[model samples]
Target: MLDFFRQFISFIPPALVPLALLAIALLLVAPLGLFAFNFLAIKTLFEELRKIFQDIFKLIIPKKWDSAKTLIWLSVFSWAMSLPTRSFVQSFIAFCGWLLLIPGIHWLMHEEKKIKEFLTIEKILIAPWITGALICFFLFATPESLPGIMVISWPIVSAIIAALPKFIKSGPAYKVPDPPVRQDLIIMVLFNLLLSCWIQLCYSTQVWLAQYPSFQADDLTNSSFVVKTPSNESAVSQGFDILRQAETALKDSLQGQSWSQVERWLLNFDDRIRDLNEQIIDRLPPKAENAYWQVEGRVLPGEYNVQLFAVWKGPSSDNLGYHLAKTCQISQGVPVDRTPWQTLSPVGSASPNTQVDTATVSCEPVTKRIKGQPDMAQ
Candidate 1:
């Protein structure tokens, strides 16, 4: 298991950094494009519930009070003060809203305490039940910041709405019964489904954060990163090399020319490189800690991969290590076959299929030589 975790940590996140970025990007962008789709689903469901409410009113109450007006007023009241009110004001308005909905309105109009007024014989059950269901559907959905009020408050209101009808109609001879378990169940399911979907939406949006790349630890700090950059090179050249290598690898791995593919590759590629960059620093002693790399994942124009860069400290790889790191690119350098984190081969080594086991224990960076001289490598 320890070996498993070590191996697991070695490459999956890094290998699929490009893919993961694409998956996350899709998660964010898809829902936005499909926002209207979910909205339409909610709207259709509410319309059906509203139709049911009106029909039920006609069946039970001969003198039907158009309660939809009251419902609208209640909603307006709930929203008006709900968002702006804070601390005491928030609580005060809520208390008044609760009052208007119950005894106060019933007394003002019907001249009866709400408890008794609501218990009147002619009151219907189905309409209120449906209304409660609708309210429940909408309530938990809202990602509003102070959703504390709605989260707890609306459930009570729903209970009241679902119950008032049956209570009013049932006489002492017949106690008001609970809303059918099936009806309650359906609403609960619908509410849960809505909650899941809404949460997914929020999750997608948050996933769109920009991915900044790191090259190396400062002259002294030993930060962890995946890809390292050549420190002595001009900043522009270092960035270019990282970008070029990432782009080339992506085109080769994916073997597709689509821009979408390229964009996704870059994200994952950079993440893996960052992982590699950090591992390099972890092994260094605190003093002249020089094995840090720049970390970046930039989207290329009309390309499917992001270019990544890493910088190293210490002796050059040519002198200290044998194989020179060669960037891979697909045909015409157009399509990206692999990304930054796609498992890399050891430089100056003969094996092409060496496994990139645990990142920390598997690989070590041989510092670049002081100059580009090949003789110094021996």
Candidate 2:
């Protein structure tokens, strides 16, 4: 079932995913828009929403008088509905946002007992759940700064918002308190707007990085056989000579062999080359630590391709290593007639059968630092 949902989301364009998340964030905070327009209308809006939800859930769970609790549950319901549709990181941020609201809801519920007229609509509308959604959007937008922002700013801001009423009471109480004109409400709205801008910045950074990553040149070089060494001509020449010698020896040894015989002969030849490589590395200078050579070859009917890789620790103070690869190919050997003389006696053949014996050789060189080795020149 989860896989089916994932497949459905996969059909949506990659660029649309983040936009959809942003849309959801805006939708979650749509109540803030209403609160900004007229605080009284928010109360009416929530009253209607509460009644609708109570009717819908009446069949499952009995409706209670705790509207604040119901609003909190509805926030959780929003998170649950969005979680499965979003990516793992987005889902995690949404979950954290939900977690951040629990304390705020508990504080509001506790404060309702002390205050003579608890502003239920005002408190519920600007709850930590809404702020958490804004924070989640910021986190998804700017993943690099997520930990710092969440750890440093989140708790401090939440605490101030939770203790806002007490701070206001310590000053002077208006005959009729205006929630919108409150200092904490103003700060919260400004902070949320700033966070929205931060989200935009993060999204832009992500797009830039995706288009031009830090190590693009290095990635390209690694993908191809281009050599970085100062001198690759000598290595390439040597590889060609070595491949020519191997091909000459092989042709002489397996001139008239069948396909099975040819395969066995090539296997033995490979083993001999392996032993030779070990011997060659052993003769290298003592400074060449972790020195090794690798020889690989492929044989076609009348063609052969070979590659030799050489790697050794450099004599640099940092214990860096050097690596080089040379590939060579021999192709289109002349084919010779191998049928016995008596087989052609009935026809009294006068023409001597043609054979292909010639083979061509070519080599190319590549160089890079050995794995786990530092860059010596750098």
Candidate 3:
């Protein structure tokens, strides 16, 4: 068994060895820690911590006023004061929010006392469950401070909201009637589990949107419940920008050249297209696999046309996936006298009437979806 452990440890990456060892140590220590929690020394330490909290609370609050009432009123006052500014309000709200939970739980426990004495309710005072729940609520309420982690906070907040009432009602001290477990308590537990799963699924949809932004551009008429449709500015508009840049490059490099020279440039156009792709990749965020701009060019009489396709290789209802496309047209610019006519001639000799036309490019608006895979480059 020791040799087997050694062999397993060797398979772990060098950087992860310490983490793996720490995890193993935690697994071994957790049961021992739980068993030791009921020891007299541990109880003494907890009692001391409780005294420290009480002392701190007394120092901050005046003895003349009720502590819970004062804290609640002050929190309300601070909230009203913060409404107009909307700046640094989240931090103040978070601080007061968690503090409010102390009185909140106290009120709940006090109300439950009116019914019957529950020994289990007293145990909750020593435990940190309420503290953890309040922290989750604070995180969920103040999204601006930690937006990325808000999704994780939702399920914790939901579970606590669903179970707290039931937890307060079903104390172990309550005598069991005809049924050992109350039907309502069982139903609440099952309902809370389903609610947590639903919350998780909602967050997962948001993750999918982040991975495939084009989905945001799709019809959200039926998906309003799952995802709020953003503004037109946030839609899949990268295809238009990519085509615009490619059109600019075509005009900058191939403009003012004769038809013959332009033909020669087209022969090696694939290299130019490849360079454009490299430049685009460097400028934009890393796209999903096979989801990049693919440009296909066509040569027309005295003109060149190219199609820019924004390919998507991510989750889609369609098997072939989808793409956005825009077409760019390149035409000749006004004629200009060739430098060769003036430079090559003698100083006294008259220059010939030789001129070369330059090229210009214009692109059309992006089509929503081209439906099929992009055509091979010409």
Using lDDT, give the best candidate's number.
Answer: 3
Q: Score residue 314 of candidate 2 by CA lDDT.
A: 30
- Backbone clash pairs for candidate 3 read 256-358, 333-358
Q: How well is each residue in 179-212 modelled by candidate 2, as lDDT tens digits? A: 7556665676577557655655556544643432
Best-to-worst order by lDDT is 3, 2, 1
Q: Pairing residues by index, what is the TM-score of model 1?
A: 0.23
* C-alpha lDDT (0 to 100) for residue 362 of candidate 1: 13
Task: Give the alpha-carbon lDDT of every model.
Answer: 0.44, 0.50, 0.61
Number of clashes in every candidate structure?
58, 6, 2
Ranking by TM-score: 3, 1, 2
Best by TM-score: 3
- For model 1, the superposed segments whose C-alpha errors exceed 4 Å read 1-94, 101-169, 172-184, 187-378
In the range 83-107, model 1's lDDT, one tens digit per residue, is 7879888767765665455433333
Q: Report residue 129 deviation for candidate 3 (angstroms).
A: 13
lDDT tens per residue, model 3, 97-193:
5577556454444444432255246433312344435556565555546454454454445445544544453444434433433665466456646
TM-score of every candidate relative to the true structure: 0.23, 0.23, 0.53
